[model samples]
Target: MKLLLFVSLLAAAYAHGDCGGDCLKACRSCTCDLPNDGPSTDDGESPFQIGNKYSGDCKQLICKDHNASLIVDGKIYDRLVCFQGAWHFGYPEFLEEASSAMCLNPGNRTCPDDAEMRYEDDFKCMCKPDFEDMSDVFPDAPEDILPLCTNCGKKKLRITFLIDNSGSMASVIHEIKHFIGQLVKFLKVSETGNNIAVVSSAFSYDVLINWGEQSHDESAIHDAVDSIDADGQSYLATGLEAVKAALVQPTDENTQHKLVVFTDGSIKCGPEALKSLARAANNLEHLKVETFVVATNSRYTTRLHAIANGVEDNVFSISSEEDDEMENLKVAAKLQRRICA
Candidate 1:
């Protein structure tokens, strides 16, 4: 009788062990037979009464029938089973959460192909180096979410400014300067990949700021603009020729080239000079030239419009006689919108 009792006790112990110590109250036939009465702790040894809870890696789990239950928003729904000593979700609806919860730190978080996980005040996915941030254009986007990123290679632009520095432009030089300053601010020239070059059109064409020369420095570009002064005659054709030469230089295939001309409707040479200007402007292979005629008289408007390929949208006229300050601001704002588009 003593030997039989010892063997029975040994069998009970083996059954309890096979149940992974989850059957604290009762282990019947090598299984937990009691509901809401199992080990609540992660170690699987202590008994958990009804309504007891256990904290898992991603979520808090409640004990029910020796299995962990998933509770979301104060309601317990699905059961979580123990696999390899860790609680795993049993339902497909929670799979995404399970995968995301594996990342305990930013370094472990997975990001999209164009982005990478980073930590600032908190863990976030940010755009990679070769990508550009397009946040400003999306004003209605959520504040907490990061903006979408775009490829830098596709959005590159190269802009050249050809300003007429003839003696007739003395009255509007300051306005031109203000316009240039506002444009620089709007373009975020110092922070972006776009390039700005300034060519002065007078008795001769002078390249004040060459392509990629101090291109990223806003203060330097402004200083160059400030140095410009009204002098000599407007050699418009020569200026166009210079701009054509500059645009012909090899650039990235994806780059969009633009020429912005600020003239006071004065050309030194006669009809032949106009023809020369037209030829020079027409021969530009991949350039979009915009003409801004700033003058008090409408004498040169027709000629300048012709030079702009008769596109009224391409030619902007600003009258120096009416509200100089307001007109410059309004025209500058318009140019900003067009260029940024």
Candidate 2:
């Protein structure tokens, strides 16, 4: 019985010794050289102590009974044994590579080669401009898993705005500008890789901004909008043709096109001219250019709907009461959803 007791004690000693000298050394030194701020303890202690945990960095460390353990994204680094006072797998080169790897959330998955990890509200893996997200295909997969992505070859978007700068629009021009400004903020034009153009439609059409001219310059785009002086008759056909020409400019074959028209309707043109506008709008449909219209006047809802390929939801109506800042904000939000969808 004494021999049996002695053997059991020897096994206990071996189990404790398994923690190794490096782990004990790491615990004693308590060095955590992570990218973010210096190490912090969960209990708000200045110096780390046993039962203390260092978190919020690339890697996590916890000092336990005379030993230290490395963790990442709630997963213990079982294979990474402590060296000196740092966590390392094997060689110094391997340690460097591991340190550089990004820690993504949902499931702490590594981003794909063609993707990059971005932080907005949380960490997200965004596919490169030329790649498409394939996460929808794996609906049953855990949310923590990294998204699957594939190269899309070429991805380009061209959006054109046709604003009716007619004599009648002068009353609500400020509301139109507000909507445009809010849309620009939501779109993040510079980051989305989209080219933007603006056309002012009066008796004649004016290309206020050309595609790819102010694509990345939000301030310049706003300046162009501010320069709009509402006057002349509303020539819808002229603006439609101008938009068509701008969208047809040479671009990638896979380029997606969008057209947004801000008008109070009140087309001063005759029936033949209106028919011509309808035909031009139809031509854009044939080219697969998504179209939307915002009617500043509720009375012109029918006219705006007709311009929007006869799609009722594609036309947004802003009543006189709804021209205020708060109301225009709601309208812009709805418009953003449709355009993005």
Candidate 3:
């Protein structure tokens, strides 16, 4: 009877004002103070209560489940919220209980056993990374749950480089060599086994090096690249045709096929055939093509753009106006975003 009466009194106190109305019962020991309540509109919403969790709203991927909540060390926190992908902080209304839950304690090692803090572009943790942002294919429908990345086993990702070795590329071969070296480094860190191949075109075309399968022979790839010297004409169509034919042939469904082409000139060998080959390669369900042109010149851009399956994001036209080092760095950064994201 005494225990029951004590519980009743504690519940009453909890209902009144446990932590000065700033936090839920679970975060009572948290030391951070709430931001200013500011002004409340007639609708009963205020800056202090709504928004202000992160700098702005999350963009890129929407949350699968917004109503989800989690209990950590006896405290409740919002588990899932939608990201509008607008790159701002204008999220729709969230549960009132989620306000204090966003302010996590960095020092406390009391995160839930199943979840880890999510870092955004700002690298701060107001969200959990486990919640995946779905592709924009479904604009209107939101999913009930976000799928988590599985580490069930290692997968294979096949990367093919269609390098331009024309006479005009002599000036930029040094930059290209550095870029490939960096690419090897990036792939080395990936969770999957990566297979690297090189196909170059000049007055003639040749597969400089082929390890047969996805091999971790970084030194071999580097050696093949080192052996390449710019001396022939750019025959882009021939290279694309060869790549398209190879991609359509039988291969493992588990292997992801990616073709990255580096060029600076037009297809001197065949123009019409290049278009057909590019369209065919893009249409291949198993292949993704990303092309980089060394010239910002409109003529070069148009040619590379067409060869990139008409996707602007996949076509990177580096301007000759900038220093070679700077341009290569930019290309490396952009590739990191696409490949690592």
TM accuracy, model 2: 0.54
Lowest summed-lDDT stretch of 10 residues in model 3? 144-153
* CA displacement after TM-score superposition, residue 52 of candidate 1 (Å): 56
Residue range 231-279, candidate 2, lDDT tens digits:
9888888789777776565545587888999988889767887788788
lDDT of candidate 3 over 1-341, digit per residue (tens): 64564464345334433333333223322322332212233454422231223422221112222322232222433332212211112223321222322222234333222235442321222224432222132233222211122211133556677787888888877667776775565454232466777888776678865546324577878888888898877777677666656642466556566677777755564656566646654655335444433343456666677666667777665544424544554455456345434
Give candidate 1's whole-model lDDT. Answer: 0.57
Clashes per prediction? 0, 2, 11
Global lDDT scores for all candidate models: 0.57, 0.62, 0.49
Which pairs clash in model 2? Answer: 106-144, 107-144
Ranking by TM-score: 3, 2, 1
Error of 3 at 302 (Å): 2.2
- TM-scores vs. true structure, each candidate: 0.52, 0.54, 0.54
| Whole-model lDDT, model 3 | 0.49
Highest lDDT, which number? 2
TM-score, predicted candidate 1 vs. hidden true structure: 0.52
lDDT of 1 by residue, 1-341 (tens): 64564465455444444332334333343222222322245455433231234311212233333433333222233443222223334443232122211111233445545566654445566767866655564444344434345453333467778888999999988877877875665555643576778889889988888766576578878988999999898887788788777654555556677677887777766788788877776765335444443343457876677556566676776666535655554555455445545
Candidate 3 residue 120 Cα shift, in angstroms, is 14
Instruction: Name the runs in model 2 displaced over 4 angstroms.
Output: 1-156, 250-252, 320-323
The superposed Cα distance between candidate 3 and the true structure at residue 283, in angstroms, equals: 6.6
